[model samples]
Target: MSYLEFLGQYGDRILSGTLVTVLLTVLSSVLAIAIALVTGLMRLSPNAVLRGIATVYIEIFRGTSLLVQLYWIFYVLPLFGVTLEKFTAGFVAVGMNLGAYGAELVRGAILSVPRGQWEAALALNMTPARRMIRVILPQAVLIMLPGWGNLLIELLKGTALVALIAVADLMFQVKQINGTTFLSAETFGTALIIYYVIARFMITPFMRWLERAMQRKLGRA
Candidate 1:
């Protein structure tokens, strides 16, 4: 079939799959961001216990393979009666894996803030929380925006892995269509274009806009 004919025949299904891909990427990004912030803060905590716990989490997640983590969450966890749906397992695994990486970004960004900022907060008798919220994070987040933007694209690409566990994402649907039609070039090529459009047109623009907004807020624009 011609490419247009193929799209006409399977467009609805592909659209559905793209929507799922977008949803999964968005939810996973949110989860990953939250995890990064928490663990990243914990890594810098004065309390040794918090630091230790954060270190262990970062090490275990970063040390392991993401595919293995997915399988363990979907398969092994059920053995212990902590069952998760396929979609949940997919996003959670992706989020956790990326979050481990993002945590380091956060830690580094926070550290990149001038040491004088911390002392200024201390001089003002600011609590640790207030200092982070008021002074440190505002600066650190600027450094973080560029890294997080890169991570967002990585997360988008990583969503393809969810197809292995049978989430009906774009790649999963492409595989299904290709299996039936045997149009390897058309099917796979279309999928590639779709992913690129998302990352290039949608995700990239949004991240740039977000960075600009944050910069404006900080009077750095």
Candidate 2:
């Protein structure tokens, strides 16, 4: 079949899959950001216990393959009576794996803030929490925006792996269509274009706008 004919026949299915992909990416990104911030802060804590816990989490996730993590969450977890739906499993795995990496970015950005800033906060008798909330985080966020943007894109691409566990994401639907119709070129090509458009047009632009907004807030623009 021609590409047009293929799209016409399977457009609805592809659209549904695209929506699922977007939803999964959004959920995973939010979870990742939260995890990154918590773990990153823990890594900076003076308490050895907090630092140890953060270090273990970061190493375990970063050292392992994401695919294995997904499979373990979906397939192996049930063995221990800790079952999760396929979608939830995929979301958690992707969030956690990327969160580990993003944590390092968060830590580095926070550390990059000048020593004088911390000293100034101390001089003002600002509590640690207040210092981070009012002074350190604002500067660190600007520095971290570029790294977070890159991680967001990577996380978007990583959502494709959810297909292996039956999440019905873009890649899953593409595989299904290709299997049934045996039109590899048309179906897979269309899937590629759709993914490229979503990442290039949608995610990239939003991230750039966010960076600009943050810069303006910090008077750095």
Candidate 3:
């Protein structure tokens, strides 16, 4: 079939899949961000026990392959009685796995904040919680924004793997249509274009805007 004909037949399904992809990306990004924050902060904790736990968490997730993690979440977890829906499993695995990596980014960003900032906060007798909320995290955010933005795009691309576990994301939809119609190049090519559009026009620009806004907010501009 011609590409237009293929699209006419499957465009809506693909669009729906694209929307699912975006939704999953957004949801996972939120989860990843939250995880990054918590674990990242834990990395700075003075308590050796807490710091060790956070360090192990980050290392375990980061040390393993994401595909293995996804499969374990989807396939093995059910065996352990922790059942998750396909979408939920995909989101959790992707968010958590990426969050482990993001934790390093957060930890580094927090550490990169001038040592004077911490000393100044302590000198002012700011409470630990207040210091994190008011003094440290804000400054770290500007540095973290760029790294997290890149991770967001990685999350977007990573959603494709969800299809392996039966999530009806863009890649899954494309596979289904391609299997039935034998329109390999057309379906996949369109999927590629759609992802490109999202990454280029939507995700990239949004990340850039976010980074710039953060820099301005932090007065680094």
Candidate 4:
């Protein structure tokens, strides 16, 4: 079949897969950011225990391959009597892997906030929590935007790996359509175009908007 015919027949399936990919990206990114914030703050905490726990989490995820982590969560965990649905396992693994990288970004951003700001907050008699919430994080978020934007793009790309776990994401559907139609070039090329469209038109623009909004909020735009 011609590429146009293939698309006419399989377009809905491809679009469905794209929606699943988008859902995975959205869910995993949110989880990753939450994990990054908590663990990054813990890594900087005065308490030795919190620091140690965060250190272990960051090192373990960063040290290992993401595919290995995903397989462990999906396949290996079942042997230990812990079973997760494929979607959940995939999202958790991707979130955890990216969260490790994001933790360092968060830490660096927080540290980039000038010492004078911390001192000013302290001088104002603000509690540590209040200092972070009211003074420190706002400044740090602006600094972190560029790094976070990159990570978000990485996370979107990484969603392709979930197809291996039978998640029926865009990549998975591409494979299915290619196998049945024997139109590998058309199927895979279209998948590539879709991914590029998502990253270029959707994710990048949104992140840029967010950066501008944050800058405006900070009176720095």
For residues 1-221, what per-residue lDDT tens digits would candidate 2 score against the true structure?
77787888999999999999999999999999999999999999999999999999999999999999999999999999999999999999999999999999999999999999999999999999999999999999989988988898899889999999999999999999999989998888988998899889998899899999999998988
TM-score of each: 0.98, 0.98, 0.96, 0.98
True-structure lDDT of candidate 4: 0.95
Model 1 residue runs over 4 Å out of place are: none
Q: Tens digits of per-residue lDDT for model 1 on 111-183?
A: 9999999999999999989999999999999999989988999999988999999999999999999999999
Model 2 stretches with alpha carbons more than 4 Å out: none
So what's the TM-score on candidate 2?
A: 0.98
Better model by TM-score: candidate 3 vs candidate 4? 4
Residue-level lDDT of model 4, residues 1-221, one tens digit each, is: 77787788999999999999999999999999999999999999999999999999999999999999999999999999999999999999999999999999999999999999999999999999999999999999999998998999899988899999999999999999888878888999999999999999999899899999999999999
Off by over 4 Å in 4: none
The candidates, ranked best first by lDDT, are 4, 1, 2, 3
lDDT per model vs. reference: 0.94, 0.94, 0.91, 0.95
C-alpha lDDT of candidate 1 relative to the true structure:
0.94
**Model 2 steric clash pairs:** none
For model 3, residues 1-221, the per-residue Cα lDDT tens digits are: 67787778888999999989999999999999999999998998899998999999998998898899999999999999999999999999999998998999999999998999999999999998999889999999988888887888888888899999989999999999989988788989889999888888998899899888878888887
- Tally clashing residue pairs in candidate 3: 0
